[model samples]
Target: MQVLRPQTSGNVDRVLDCHGNKVVLISRRRVFSLTAGCATFLAAPYLSLRQSRASDAIELPEVRGGGKIRIGLLWSLTGHLSVIEKPSRDVALYWIDEVNKSGGVGGYQIEPVIMDAKSDLKTYRSAIMTLMRDEHVLATFGGYLSVSRRAVMPLVTENRGVFYYPTCYEGRECWQHIVCTGPLPNQHSLDLIPYMVRNYGPSAYFVGSNYIWARESSRNAIEWLTQAGGQLLGEKYVPLGQDNFDVICKDIKNKRPDWIFSTVVSDSDIFFRKEYARQGLSSDRVPIASLTTSELEVKKLGVSYGEGHILSAPYFQSLGGATNAQFVDRFLGSRFGESGVTHFNMEETYLAFLYFKKSVERVLQENGHVPLTPENVRAFSGGLHLSNEESPEGEVHLDPDNLNSWLKPKIGRFNGLGQIELLWQSSEKVSPKPYLLYPERGVCLSDGLHLPNGTIVKAAS
Candidate 1:
């Protein structure tokens, strides 16, 4: 394994020699260049799309006379990621239908331009171009994987388009064109690692899919684990569709770590969880704690295989309260029916549209009958808050600084019925520390995170 050493370059901290891969960690205040691969791809399609479709004074579709505000919904409807992405697409469609029922946003009915990227990078590239060029969508929402997000991000930025990303991702990015409604590592790992260490033990084994989201999330998990005085047993990353974990489970059983930190997502997660149980292991002994497993996966894996494993997410379908109750009822009554159990991704997907609606209304209210464009909506969207009435998660705040949401962090385990039974929850919403925002001295061992402007906010215990 190549040891990566952090070196200061200007104001950025660059990690060198991580298996010959350069990792650039950007600060909260500054913007960093996209990856070389992303830059190269952008040089061709990104420019051509911007030049051909974008203009200095972009024409706004008139709300009157059958004019519709075309909103793009790009997701994997038929692929490995379809299990997760399709639910989000359904939520987006549900939100669109709900908005239109209420007379739409700012006197315009949303015309959805939906595309299935088929979980392929090349498909994502072409599909996003279709949304931006041919369909001329006002804003696009999709991307479950970090690679998919990175694939079309340059295009989104170059065209000055808006993208409401709903997946909880590995942070270190602050994009002006993206509104991230999902939690970051600080939201998931910070609260989850310590809780696991305290209850389970001070030793862990990391297993994740071989992808940017899993690798980077695991990297942060290790940092948080070390800070809490926990020991790492071993760490492994497997290919995306890797179904066999016989060797990995054998190693885990031999090492006998207190807990397994899993960043494995999608269909692979189901297989891994079942394989863990099939190895004569139980979560009561060595639980597979995950950031990605939700009601969606739990249902597929069944209660026998999924129960006792822990999950950390902002929202769960089984949560009690009138707000969540109403949200659940509405979704269950929808075309998706009971089978479409709401998860973290779907909740955030719905919240994205809520924010979009509020952002558009605010723009129209302040500017007074002005034409709605992606730029204006983007300008008004930062730092938007939704109350418990509007949000099922009680309260949500989109951080103006980083374009990420301040989310309520909750940890839970699957019950007998394949639903999340809440274990621990923050007293209030935890602020987003997408860039880590650790103190200059060292990693903060407590729940408190040091912000860029010198404010240290304490997370709920």
Candidate 2:
């Protein structure tokens, strides 16, 4: 019943009252590049229907005695990461809304405890602590950067709470308490590096944000690059939110690598692409190939900034297929339409919720009325499969051993038409290898992880 004033931050627009919870509105500047008339025609009824459903749900009392199932949503909603992470959070909410509309999850209405980490590590820790101890959520989802993930890993593990990470990361470790739906290094670069080497030249340069994700992902890139007989011309890791890429641009110009592999994220990603283009580096000859860049960044930086550039991901907004077409249309018509496009991060978050919902349903069916504890949810989530219609990105499977999704890898190039054109994709889903280098540490056990030689390292309880 309390209407708070709008936040003046550049990352957020006005807040809406969804029942008692506040949902952040998207800014007008981020709308899709479609024609005004077409966009309005497509989006109007969708928005109206969504708003009406939200109202009906809010007005209605609890239909089932299952009550509310609380979960935590952590993201940097007002800092450097707001651009991508906000949409990611919105996608999670989107799936949550759909779940509630369809009779709730296992007869329980879901309630989310949303918090902003502000792109700060300390804030991530504090928020997870509150979600764990105070909110006591069944599971928490969100974390764009590796450092933020590391900041909250121990807390989630120690408390035995579930955490779902939705972005591609440097896959090095897998914990029993966390579920990673994003593609790992092997899932992405296993084919990407060889494809680049075959089509482009054999020399590459690396640029990324200074953190565990960039450092570890670059390490995997180098491993694959070396295996492909490619040379590493140079490498650099800048701090997050660092906009100026002049020095790095100069180095790239001098080194003249055949391709540039970028791991920079958020606002920094937009700045890097703009600076690289401003330096007169043509994507045709010395294109920038990235694991982190997506349609969201390209939309913000302008379609021209991404023309001819290569990107590897599990999903892209421009992907063809009836399911993907419907997915994109729904996104373009939703309250979060300001995002303009659906990318890997948002899609993976949607997949995570799907996984959660299916797992909870299975658990309920088997147990016949039991508490949806973190352990029960985690136990059933592994080795789950989702059909093509259910998942926008074809069919996907979650590996039982590693708790990471067996994702279909894809390579795409941004064209002048403001969309990424698919170039290559795995014939089938690729199993995730979190520890790409050390296979022994890849498998997960109840007590602990496996050793290099398949020996189980039991956890001390």
User: Which candidate's TM-score is highest?
Assistant: 2
- Candidate 1 residue lDDT tens string, 34-85: 2223335434534433554545533433233345777888888776788889
Q: What alpha-carbon RMSD in Å does predicted model 2 have with respect to the real structure? A: 11.0
Off by over 4 Å in 2: 1-65, 440-442, 452-455, 458-461
RMSD of each: 12.9, 11.0
Instruction: Provide the lowest-lDDT 10-residue window in model 1.
Output: 26-35
lDDT tens digits by residue: candidate 2, 1-461: 12366664554344544544444432222222111222242233223223222222221111123667777889878777789898988787776766777788888877766777776655776677667665567888999877667667666665667899988887767577788889989988778887899899999999998766788888888888999999999999887788999999999999889999899888999888888888888898699889878888888888899899999999988877898888778766866566878888998998899898888888888887766687788889888998898888889988887688998999999999768899999897898877668664546555467676766653211
Total backbone collisions, model 2: 0
In candidate 1, clashing pairs total: 0
**TM per prediction:** 0.83, 0.85
